[model samples]
Target: MSDAPKAANPTGADPEANQPGLGDLRVIVANHLKRRLPGRSTMREDVAAGMSIAVGNVPDGMANGFLVGVNPIHGLYATIMGPIVGGALSSTQLMVITTTAAASLTASQPLADMPVEARTGALFVMVVLAGLFQLLFAVLGLARLTRFVSYSVTTGFLTGIAVLLILSQLPTIAGYPVLGANRVMQTLDLMVHIQEVNPAALGLAVMTIALARWLPRTPLRGFGRLVAIIIPSLIVALFHIDGVQLVRDLGEIGRSMPTPDMPSMLRLAPGVLTGALSIAAVVT
Candidate 1:
């Protein structure tokens, strides 16, 4: 044997210098503590910001259900769990993992042809599939595909959503029966029936919108939108706007943490795969 000791493999073939895998990544994170305090401080801030965002998301999730024409309870479910999974698997931090209006609208389209029970089932299948597609993209290292969802297209989609959202709620605002299948016709119906509009409900909706618009600029700015909404809601409660057929009431606000559930592979296989493919295309 030579007098010189053998050199270890620098390319990481030696067991002692093995390259990191997914499990090794965790070990590296654990063992390689940064020397600088600023790194630790940055990590702490990230954790804090994440928690604050999570707390803010719950009510907003339920609000999205109102936008999507689904049960608010399911909206909360999707918001909470969707973020937890998508956030973990994501390579980038800027992406917000939440229900998109376009996805919600697209998901709602096929359900219109089905019975109520079947529609509910199909929605469950589709959303589950969408989640799986996100997971698949992450696993396959396809994060770059997000670039195709261009800024202008997103802006147009959001504008369309604003028009649709406002039109959808017109009946609640005007105290009239919601009518028509399309947004234009629904809006037109409200316009044509202007004589029958209820002053109280109209006032309440306008006040809510105005408050949402103006409150942010004032000194008490942080809570302006909340105050605006609460004041109108209180008025609705005190006067019992049911006589005029106003906005739907959210009776209780009980909250809970999300729990894990197994994916129903059988129910989700076919339809879920198709839905996931469609979502992946859109997301890309």
Candidate 2:
């Protein structure tokens, strides 16, 4: 065989050389899987998990914002922004430190009367502080301190939170007032007004919760929660239970999207710094 260097393409280009797209990325991933995993299979569970997280946040963010004495839109903004910022700076790959209903409620108690800009400034500060703390922790090699909280303690804490979540949503699910600006007041108020509850609304709420719990296991379960809410809500609407006490409607949905604004630094100062630090502590 003659030793000859391979000829460069005379056209000096390959048609598919720089055509980078999702399919190309997928092909690369498939090749990686073929080499690394060999026989094991995965259905992109991470994609599904991320989607679930995104969808789950919509209702939760709105509800939490309402509970926290802030516009629901802000809660939604926090949900979107928190994840991106947290993901970028956090060393932990699996951390999902978005605003929780309880955390937001706690933090907002102090910041309630503050101006929206001030509150936002506070949130920014808190995120920055939290990021700094995380970095410090990493540098200090104190990440292992998390292990001091025993597994059982962690489990119990999470379990208690789950229980609280189920109990706290009782009013929303039962079509009654959530009561109180804080946890104690809300709980007490619910207890006091337990007698004046609406049956149809309550029934609809229960059905929605049940469907949300069970429907995901079945094939057609994807739309189960929607079906549960819509069907019962429609029935309630058609019946008109009291005529005096009516189901609240948001009314006239809009299709237009809002414009985005650039963020400012000077807007966030001392109060924001304090508030953010407080919030970051509570979060940790």
Candidate 3:
């Protein structure tokens, strides 16, 4: 039987058993929880803000999942969990931690080659791996590297992502799924088949965009996006609009929360590993 006390690292940054200290993540969270609670007025504002964020994310989350080539429910689930986890660990105060179109686009690339049935499981694995990579970056304190990245490179990267996202959505907006080797080729194919565009779907998409832009100027600004989703959905149902795809069209959204599943070890190969690293880089 060993009687010697375990060695304690002075930094207490790691989760090792012997190194419990103020720097421990658990301690930090506990301290945060014990801090002065917000006053009633502040709490009311927080609740209102949270509700607004939830309403706004309903469509955005599903859209992200759709972009990832998986069931939209998964994205909705991410919207639910991502904020809880992100808020817990987040170091910054200015940003809202949630999914983004760029990261979704980056995630889609890896799943593009996967079968429909397999993509969901593969996505789960990829996400877990990406989280690990991001954690590694934090542990290594590599955030300082971003300071050295050139302004031109950052600007170009963002512009490229935005342009690609816009091009990628053209097919959906046109109610045509133009299949090609990549987004650029698909966009070209979509351009070539301009006559095949569904006027009904295009009209609705335009109206939705207009609503998104116009609503933000009024008192209903905070609810604009949420209303945009609901309004188009009601019209789609009432008119029985065909050709345009939807989140529900991709897969079933269950009535209850899904059972948590283990990430598929089969998907941990080099290709997926690279995809995970790509997602991590884009997300960070």
TM-score of each: 0.64, 0.55, 0.84
Please give the lDDT score for candidate 2.
0.58
Ordered by lDDT, highest first, the candidates read 3, 1, 2
Give the distance in Å from residue 251's predicted Cα in candidate 1 to where it truly belongs. Answer: 9.4
Over the stretch 1-284, how does candidate 3's per-residue lDDT look in tens digits?
A: 99996434344544342333424544444345344546886998889888888888887897788787889888889999989998776653334878898899998887888778888778888888898999999999986576566668988999999898888788888988798999889999998999999998899889999998888688887788878888998988898887767777787889987888886686544567889999998877
Q: Is candidate 2 or candidate 3 better by lDDT?
A: 3
TM-score of 2: 0.55
Q: How high is the CA lDDT of each candidate model? A: 0.63, 0.58, 0.80
Residue 87 displacement (Å), model 1: 2.8
Which has the higher lDDT value, candidate number 1 or candidate number 3? 3
Write down the RMSD of candidate 2 (Cα, Å): 12.5
Best by TM-score: 3
Clashes of 1: 0
Runs of candidate 3 with Cα error greater than 4 angstroms are 1-35, 267-270
Indicate which candidate wins on lDDT: 3
